[model samples]
Target: MLAHARQLLDGSVPLPAGTARVAAAMLIRRALEELAAEWSGCPEATTRSQLVIAARRLPPTEAERACLAWFALSEACHHHAYRLPPNPVELVRWLSVVGGLPAPHP
Candidate 1:
């Protein structure tokens, strides 16, 4: 699911507005589903929170930034309790995926 999300993010598959967020929500939902199936009992609140955060951090293309910013802001308003992921590796990957980083990994 994450791989599919990545593909969509990378433009391998075109996604319309709300598609990325929906995809991410579905992936996290499935993870929670698997945990519930095993009686592992995932924290729905925390997972939902993180997925929201990830969706917000998604980069917008230059042409789409204005529209995406509005969408992102609306999503933020509803999910105000969510916290962004803090792990360094995850942060780096998120920035890279969002096109906030330089090319070729120099």
Candidate 2:
């Protein structure tokens, strides 16, 4: 999902800037949610609150970053007439946040 989002932003995929940004944001959100579910040992990341709860378990600074990233990604994923899609920079920042999360141990 993160790779797809990177492709969307990197022009490997043909998408308008606005559309690609939103699509990338959506993909990043999915990746973040899955990471949160795993990190929290929850059955699933079924709600925004679940993600927040997961974020809160991290070290203080990381927890703050995770919460902010989740909020930004969630907002970016929505389609609202008055709102603009996230810019590449913002999406990339969220991607970094998602990437920074720990992967589940085998």
TM per prediction: 0.31, 0.86
Candidate 2 wrong stretches, greater than 4 Å: none
Candidate 1 backbone collisions, by pair? none
lDDT of 2: 0.81
Instruction: Please provide, for model 1 over 25-60, each residue's C-alpha lDDT reduced to its tens digit, 9 standing for 90 to 100.
Output: 444334333322222233454433433433344343
Q: Please, what are the lDDT tens digits per residue for candidate 2 over residues 1-90?
A: 999999998999999889989999999988877777766777554656666676667777876776788888888888899988898899
Which sections of candidate 1 miss by over 4 Å? 39-106
What is the total number of backbone clashes in candidate 1? 0
| Candidate of highest TM-score | 2
- Model 2 collision count: 0
